[model samples]
Target chain A: MFQPSMQNIYRYFIISLLITVAVNFSAAQNKTAGSDKSSEVKWWNGFLVKMDVVSPVVTGFSDSEHFGMEGSVQFNLKRKIFPVYEIGFGGADKLSSNAIRFNTNGVFQRIGVDFGLLKQSNDKELINNMLTGGVRLGWSNFSYDLTNLSLSDDYWGGSQTLNFEGRSTTKTWYEIVVGIQVQVYKNLYMGWNIRNRHFFKEDTSGNIVPWYIPGYGKSGSSNTGFNYTIGYHF
Target chain B: MKRESGNNDYFNFKNLFNILKNFLHNNFIKSTVFIWITAVFFFSTSCIVSDEVCRKEKNSRLKVGFYTAILNSSTGNYTLSTLSIDSLTVNGVDSLGNIMDSVLYNNSKNLSSIKLPLNKFSNESKFIIRFNDSIQDTLTVFHTNYDQYLSFECGIIRNHLIDTVLITNHFVDSVKIQEHNVSTIDAEHLQIFHN
Candidate 1:
């Protein structure tokens, strides 16, 4: 006799749910685009506040060792340019595969400007959508504790363990961003962006490198980040 | 009435198909695709994490030069010159006063220079050196070992500073410390004089 397994049933259920949501979302988007009307211009309408919901959600869903949150405020100029300030808090308690452990929490901030690239048309002047390319300068200051770093000699018969506590450092970096924003409601927007981050200064003189940075993902030669944001217009 | 409804449905399908085609050709979609492709290419090409291996054998060993007191006819005195030791054997001594056999050389015939590794964890290294002259000398090296962290891949290496060297006068008449800092860099650290 043929039978469906529990895992198969769950997978089928999720697939059907995703299809239904996609269809409904497309229909809502068409209706909103057809009915949206232009509002009277005001100076305060250019200001916005946004929260990066994806970063917090991703950090929450991750396994033990990491947590993060980020938010930003931006000003639109001439509907062609945007100036933004973003702030975030992050922490990690990780034991590396080699048994080296590190624990830290810190704050990071970034200031940036975004340029709109969407072509303007008289017919779609009422639509509030943007395709943006931007650049950011980021900074973070943090203290960390590294423990259980073991050292052993191959030829000589001896071993030692080392620990460093409250080591403090400051870092500066820059990021190039590419993203899009769409007006999902009268005064609400949903957007997503991808950023390429490069470090301006990193300390490698010590034997250990910082495994994770606050705003940055993994501390490496370079890093990449993705953010999904929800915003409200004033 | 049914035929007319069928034709209307076909016209709506053709209009939807044209809309999809126009959306595919939109500038925003094209730009997004370009950026994503560039990002993927850059990520795949640059995201390489490599573990560095320790290459230089520095500070790991101590070098000693063998010198003989040869008579110089021009100066009318014995001067130091290179001497080759034959049938040399070196052994280490344990903390309990037991001889740990062949810590450096095992009845090997050394020509001129030999590199000997110091004990990493211990502050003292004791060696019994024997030569073909049927003479045995006890050489004791007093040192302090400092922990040094290399990279993650290389782990920890110990650096040594020689406090003092004590040697029994047998075949070796005297000892001189030329360099006290012991590291992996190959340089003569001591001079053993044979008369």
Candidate 2:
């Protein structure tokens, strides 16, 4: 049923090709410029603590059906590899158009590692800038409530109202992330990233699946999310 | 020309820092931030709320088709063929022989199959079938009903499993069960064989 036009495919291909060429060129330049200075950075170059500023603002601007806030601590290794630990809390109070209401709130955690694509420079001005790609494994455990659910027998001439409360579930998912971070001021950094997230398991039939999973957006197989973060470097 | 490389590095870092400070103060960074904010705003507002309605059939009914047995000459075996009735009237009844108010088929002409709703509250459903308004037969179905949760939008529906069938031998010869499991999905569950 879904068909991609040749023009669109060509356009996407061209864009991706351009991006690849640009990144390769930049990395090549950095490689030549920082070949001798790369050893100056230490293996453990401290850590950065960041807080997401996009989720709260975006959810507030939207219908407010969902809201989430998250923070992360990423340890820098030789200004190249980053091992990160992130935690967040998310909640939703959504009422469907048909009067079915769902409510939930819980905490979620993620552990991951990122690889910097840009070679490190000894120059302090360029030392705090990075182009990074990473993968994350996230887990959450939460309970939800669904109310005002009704079933009607039109032919048999009867209707029954059903409600499920305190139904708990555990969910695990993975994310592929790409982002850029730059030092805006002394010891202060600003960055943004886009994530493509996918769940490890699907909801089985006849199960009362939650309308929204904490930190995972809507209840579905995959979701795309964006985050803009501000961090302080130690 | 022969200065220390460390001093050259420090001078270059200072110059680069000043250039970065000037770039941050320029309108370029401000414009980029504005574009990023606009993009985020659009992305946040673009989420379309799902308006999915319950599209699956929720009614659980028993499907009965009329058939006639014909003998195959070469194989000497009886083969079943579909039979259409001229006129048929079907309605449910209680155990006391009192007909319910609902009529499933009211003089349906040239009907080969009919669907009847089973009772969710009772274990047995009785239906009176009047053929051509002249001959009548009573068909009884014994089934067990269970609840199945479909989804939040569709809620729940009662499904049935057929155990046995009892019918009066008036104008109907014999009855056969084709399929036993009955839910919202439409399928032929019973067959009525007549001459």
lDDT of 2 by residue, A198-229 (tens): 89888786667888888788877667678889
- Candidate 1, residue B70: the lDDT equals 90
Question: Which residue pairs in candidate 2 collide?
Answer: none
- Residue-by-residue lDDT tens digits, candidate 1, B1-195: 999999898668546744643453355447556655755454444334333345544357888889988998998998878988887877777667778754578777855777777787788887788877379998889999876555443445677899999999978889999999887666899999987
Fnat for each model: 0.20, 0.30
- TM-score, cand. 2 vs. native: 0.79
lDDT (Cα, 0-100) at A213 in candidate 1: 82
Best by TM-score: 2
Candidate 1, which segments miss by more than 4 Å at Cα?
Answer: A1-45, A53-62, A116-134, A152-158, A176-194, A207-209, B1-26, B37-59, B63-88, B95-97, B109-115, B131-139, B151-156, B163-195
**Reference-based TM-score, model 1:** 0.64
- Write down the worst ten-residue block by lDDT for model 1 chain B: B43-52
Which residue pairs in model 1 clash with each other? Answer: B58-B183, B58-B184, B58-B185, B59-B183, B59-B184
